[model samples]
Target: MARRGPKSHWWRTRLLAIAIVSVWAVVTLALPFFNSISNGTGPGGVGIYVFMAEGVLVLMLALVFWFARRQQAIDREFAMAEED
Candidate 1:
């Protein structure tokens, strides 16, 4: 059986964290502009809901990534301990 290295998993988790943060940053910065654009046209209050949803989504994604990284670390530690 072939064994996988923990380094690759660590790098992958790091990349995912970076990507999630980048996306969240972009959305956070752009929300105001988007809200203004939406509010300028009409009385529709949908933009606020959309922004809220996006915020929730980004938070959920961050939470998931955090848990996944934690689980990966635990697994790696267990594997190492088993090998010892």
Candidate 2:
């Protein structure tokens, strides 16, 4: 395998950052578009606004969680993970 150093680590980190930001931006921007399509009551007859809020909140939370885990993995690969 090719040698991995700070340069490689930095490159991987940048890639991960880009990926996370892209996904975040897409989700944030697409929410309204998707909301327009699903504009109606949700389960239990909840209003579209409430449903979209809850869905977007959950999605944002999940995205954050995923980013943390993925970043950690990249850090570990470079022996840069924080000690617990």
Scored by TM-score, the top model is: 2
Per-residue alpha-carbon lDDT of candidate 1 for residues 1-84, written as tens digits (9 for 90 to 100)? 214687855665677678767766766667656776777455656757665667667766777787667656655654643333
Error of 1 at 11 (Å): 1.4
Residue pairs clashing in model 2 are none
Off by over 4 Å in 1: 46-84
Candidate 2 lDDT, 1-84, residue by residue in tens: 234788998898899889888888877777667666656545534565665678778988998899899888888888888888
Report the lDDT of model 2 for residue 64: 89
Misplaced by over 4 Å in model 2 are 1-3, 34-51
Cα deviation at 75, candidate 1, in Å, is 4.7
The TM-score of predicted model 1 comes to 0.45
- The CA lDDT of each predicted structure is 0.63, 0.77
**TM-scores for all predictions:** 0.45, 0.72
